[model samples]
Target: MPNSKPRANSLIELHKPKRASSVALVVPLKDASRECLKRLARYECPSLPPYPKSQAAAVLVGLFVGRWGDIYVLLSRRSATLSSYAGDTALPGGRWDKTDASLEDTAASFAETARFIQIGLPIDKRRVPLLCTLPPFLARSHLIVTPVVVLVTDPTLRPILNAPEVDTLFSHPLASFLHDRAPFPLPSSSPYHDMPWGPTRVRLHSFLTGREASGTKPIAGLTASILLEVAQIGYGIAPEGFEADAPGQASRRERIAWELSRAERFVEALKREGIRYDWTKEERREREKRLGRDKSRL
Candidate 1:
């Protein structure tokens, strides 16, 4: 969606720099899209056009000022009872129902509902922070998911999980995802190979935020890809001489290296924070065992 929302009036200083007491994150509504586009301009990322034919869905990339004055993104763990992607970590989102006029509206509605449930503060439409839509990604279910990035200013609010859809919710510093990590190489032939847009297969990266320590799960699939792209641009870590071109046969290795370098930076950052590189195979096996036992009891 375009950043043409009317500027916040005197009652709320939505565009001003945040003060400790202020509970809302604000930026000049006009600069919202401009800032997002500016950040993404360095890389040859392709923006998805309106996909009326595809089922439109959107995820909320909710950003908020943390207790320590750090900027963090709100994430949630799905309940195991769900039929699809059960117990997976995700951003708040769902299909664009008839009630939503556009994908952006769909994202805004979900964000408002989720934030209200997580935190006690009722969302004021006028105070909604800068929002910009990012490139769409394809989900495992084949739905085209759009990510709406929003900046949240309030720090007093805390998560109160909506247990049916979300088992729990947590916030991770936006900077943490920006740290270097290793790219998760994909098999040569994958679902992403036939994309109608940019690179068919850019090496995927891993962001191992300290989720396990807090009992929160890791984010994977399309959600992880979107976050990585957002982190690269939002945190200004894109490499020099980056071009927005389809990954060519000859330049494939170079492209992979480029993606890996960015990830390596995130890996180093995680080290500094004392977070493990990746979830251990033993941990995965233990979790699977627990799940198996829980199922047997049921």
Candidate 2:
């Protein structure tokens, strides 16, 4: 008859030989294997931008990636009471000053703006990495802007906004902009005040898209073009058709177009203030070149 009762330790020992306690036990072997597989499957590519000439003026391009794994780009809506780009959406950066040790330092200074505005937000100053600097860009204000790229890991960090400099804070998810079906048409008129692809947009685009895109429409300026470039990178798409604009080739009209599309309210406000603006032939040629057009007329 088969035995029904449970076997004692002695009975189990009789069936198997005891191993030395010195034998190491391997635990979570499957988990370790999975980790190895993940590591083997993942790859990284270095993205670098050409360095711009040493300049007094510069801009900061802050990028934030949330816990949900979604990337969100931050921009500021200037107060209507300010002089330039008033009430328009722009990046949280400005011209570099003598006190700034480096472009990275200048970009990080934005944290002070947050403090002044009493937003009670803190930025992890350590995470700001200087990716690369593009050729210096001359804005309508005759200021050459050196754009710097930075990554923000903590999105919940509240920002202390400068009441006079920044009126409101805005953010847009990268996923929303990447959708192929979304209608991201260029604005019918100028969006912002004087900026076509405002500093924020331009920097964001450069980081997103490795190269620039051209042609007259809303999303034609450097900023939008850069965003498109970044999207291409995230999707691992080859930037075959994208072009890189030459320095001083961006046009004032293109800047105007970008501003109009991005923030019509700000543009209207500037017009109400009777600000003078114009687009010249040379400016158009320069802009076209910056949009990646060559000397050959297209």
Candidate 3:
């Protein structure tokens, strides 16, 4: 039998992801906090006027300065033991608990579990401070997810690996999301399908990041979508060549607004609005064509 520690190290070497040679950045280490604060300061996060606490969800966008001064966002691979979305890459967060005073609190509390347990990061409030929340995003599950941005200040943090809920912890370059040119090795090779979401088609992206620092997995779906927005917001710039968002499209706030204006619950609203947030036959075929393959999940 092989030693587990050495086996793990060998796996990391086997899957090391391609490093981006040069990624344009407006959020360098020194300015990561300043730039994010400045950008978010100008914009107001819109409230979902209709949903109650039971319907709210949140995700923590934990950012830290890497050893080389580039800005990175923390991610985790859900433990395969989970019933749903198991083994998928996700930002640390979950549905809002009744005890949570606000979505930001829900995001922060979950983040503490993910960061501290996964990496042995200390419980010091000074190390991880919630910056602000972004506009709410409707998850495929129909619950609205609010991304709470936080900056990790300590650089010398060590690995702890005690996470029972997470199989691995990894970081991705925040700025790489802005470019369509495959800034981080995988390029657009990540399988994707432009699924119909209403009047327009939105891309359902699946990025294979290879074996990254700590542990890594493919990032896709709403998680990928959220990071794209975060990268744009943190840097105060749109994606380089492609549109991060469709031009003149109704803002996500506006999309959610349509639900509030109606009496329908979010799930019902998607059905009533002729919106296909999940893949239908249209997307299934496209995905197969794109990937030349696939699977089924519960």
List lDDT for all candidates, in order. Answer: 0.51, 0.40, 0.59
Q: TM-score rank, highest first?
A: 3, 1, 2
Which 10-residue span in candidate 1 carries the lowest summed lDDT?
249-258
Error of 2 at 217 (Å): 16
lDDT of 1 by residue, 254-298 (tens): 222222223444335345545443323433444455456657768
lDDT of 3 by residue, 1-298 (tens): 1111211111111111221122222222334434544464344565444454566777778777665555678888888888888888897666777677765566556555543455455554445544556778877676787887766655566656555777878888877776654556433544456666553456665555656554566678889888888777777787665655443344565445444434357546556545544423433444444333223321
Q: Model 1: runs farther than 4 Å from truth?
A: 1-48, 107-109, 113-121, 181-202, 213-215, 239-298
Over the stretch 145-182, how does candidate 2's per-residue lDDT look in tens digits? 54444444333456677787776665655433343222
What would the TM-scores of all predictions be?
0.56, 0.45, 0.67
lDDT winner between candidates 1 and 2: 1
Q: Report the number of clashing residue pairs per model.
A: 12, 26, 1
Model 3 scores a TM of 0.67
Q: Whose TM-score is greatest here?
A: 3
